[model samples]
Target: MTAGPAEALHSWMPHSPCGAWCLPTGDALPKVSPARRALRLATLVAVVLTGPLCALTLSVLGPRGRAAVIRGWFRMVLGALGVRLRVYRPGALSLAPEERERPRDRGVLVVGNHSSWLDIVALNALQPVRMLAKAQVRHWPLIGALAARAGTFFVDRPRLSTLPATVAEVAGALRGGAAVGVFPEGTTWCGQATGRWKRAAFQAAIDAGVPARPVALRFVVDEQCTTAAGFLGEETLLTALLRTAALRGLVIEASVLPLVSPEGHDRRSMAAAAEAAVTEALGQPEAEHAVPEVAAAA
Candidate 1:
């Protein structure tokens, strides 16, 4: 997840908001009070409600039902966070007539440029998606528990053997009509740099024989709401969110571009196509500015 670009990619682009807006530092943005408070209250409600509701619902329904419950739960979390989603026109699903004719048209994998954990809430609120998170996230205290309950697919990068199995699980999930979510950037950023698009996760959609839809996310807030200190570095889950929302006002935009079929194309081409669409939607005029050169994941 980037504020926008990694340093190398940032170098390639012409002029960028990265230099002007991004703090010269670590993996976060300046925290604002209103945003921090809004996020905290929303997360608190989600923590309180998700457990009981997800428990009853997941227990009663089958896997599909449970997944739907997770979708609703995530939407609730986004609403609590005071996030409003805006989609650019012509950014709708790229489905044929027959696909649109049916009600159960399976949702595709939502491949995105990740910025913050907030990206999760933003996508969940705006799209039909279930996120793919790191295996270590499952061990985190409160948020980890919620992720597990939501049936999040956690990947362990260190274990080579587990990678295929994990990918297989995600493929199965996608075939079963779940919209898989992935952050191709691989790491969180300080709302500044853009990141390289990871090829592996996009391969999952190709392997599953489904479309890998592009989604671009950006953090925008009233100046009164964001601050340098609270969001400057690696901060705790509760404290960071609370302080940012309490002071900063935040609105995350989720614009989904057309789906790219995995058939007969390379990963880089797919990435370029998605990047172009997202960049245009975000109102960045230049292509080189929109698509960053390959960089090791931040």
Candidate 2:
């Protein structure tokens, strides 16, 4: 059998450690003026210093209190960076009719397209969420400390032995009515295309018997995709941050799609449905799963 579209298209490129989406046209760095860069740097320093302190304060607070504090910080950060956000709730986009009608008692597993680190800030601006991040993030200086305080689940992907335990921890959080965020694609690609989403996070939703909500994230500036915001390739976190902060009139559009039920559902099928929703929302061609090279070669 021939490789599927996703496979045929994506097989050539290697996965990136930092989240990045690849575009067909290629990557072009965004230009930031000296004055704007200086201003943005100052603003970032203030936000970075304040984020951890707020995390410490919210640690002892109730869920409502913590969420309020987080949202306030997100707004401040976005304002300073000149990044506006447009959130489309159910029905406004291609979401299913029943999306808004679903029972939200149980915490939801939110999966999305990961293109830039800014995606995290944008989503948190929507609400406080516990993120499932890679283990490398756990070592990122002040950001790591703040992320830990915010209750991020860090997984060491290379150590497959720990996956079951990590899944259990994520499932426990979901069962407790805490919304969990994950980039199931494991690696970031340019937003122009998406990769195969891993099924582990979906399994956590299944274990908790909660629904998975697929959110589509896109960064736009001057009515075009802001690929410079992505963290892929050789770009460091600091570089991505600087580029994002220097952006003018940057708008983050987060379109929340329908929630897929985990009850009596298989992880693979659930992931596929979520992927399709996100692909359509982002205006990208849906990729068919590719056959493994070893299998295809046979």
Candidate 3:
């Protein structure tokens, strides 16, 4: 028998094992004035570069080669957009005897809190980390085009059953020495704060026997948005770039916290430890009473 409308809708949106919590409503993000103007010039330049970058990649090597080229280009794009990334040095590379002896061939899982669409750009700019993205990204026309070339793994977002496979694929990529960045929040948040994290990702690291690199991204303002009260989502890429450019200074601080590995612990403790480390790094409260209780269920 055909399912009811509610069932159909329920099946369409993948409900997190961790029940949802209230989202702190935010004022629309502001796009500073001067930054808006610079955005036009910046967008034009970036668009111009994309075509040639893609062409050169295809001509020089094969499919994955094209992705590597996009990876490098992404850093340039961030600079062009005035998003400055200051990375905390890669927190200690594994040096213990067991870890040191293993050929440094496996990848690390970069678990981070999601803030804006810019978070992906920021992370991509820092290094050539591959993202296991939602399938919607693949359908976003220009974004999808670039993302595919960047070697992102596109998973069907509404299909929860696929999580197992997606995690497996990610683990395989790790085995091949490609780092994977996953936003445990599974959604974006206002630049002011991070969303509750999903702990299931700890299992990915557990299965792969890889270390989890927890990181946090924070955005600070420079100029004022057109309307002090509302955000500027309508601005084009160029516009946003110009707005940021106009800033006296636009700084994005990405602090990579301690890495958690599979040694001497269960998923629950590991997840909590990872959560505490990230919260402390972000300078946010890590109170058990505040974060979604469901997040710690794992």
Candidate lDDT values, in order: 0.58, 0.73, 0.56
Preferred candidate (TM-score higher): 1 or 2: 2
Which prediction has the highest TM-score against the true structure? 2
Shift of residue 8 alpha carbon in model 3, Å: 11
Please write out the lDDT profile of model 3 over residues 57-140, one tens digit for every residue: 666786467556655566665556545555553333533545322234667877776645566766766555778777767877
Model 3's lDDT to the true fold?
0.56
Please tell me which predicted candidate would have the highest lDDT against the true structure.
Answer: 2
Ordered list by TM-score, greatest first: 2, 1, 3
User: When superposed on Cα atoms, how far off is each prediction in RMSD?
Assistant: 8.5, 9.8, 9.1
lDDT of 2 by residue, 212-234 (tens): 88888887767777566677765
User: How do the residues 1-298 of candidate 1 rate in per-residue lDDT, one tens digit apiece?
Assistant: 1222222243222222332143323535544365457656867575655566565667788755765666566656655655544444241244565433213546477877654666777676555466887676888766688778666898765455676788788888887777888876665544445556666666667777777777766655542222232232334556556543442345554555557777776667776677666656655422222323111101
Q: What is the model-wide C-alpha lDDT for candidate 1?
A: 0.58
Give the range of the ten consecutive residues with the poorest summed lDDT in model 2: 289-298
When 1 and 2 are scored with lDDT, the better candidate is 2
Better of 1 and 3 by TM-score: 1
Model 1 scores a TM of 0.71
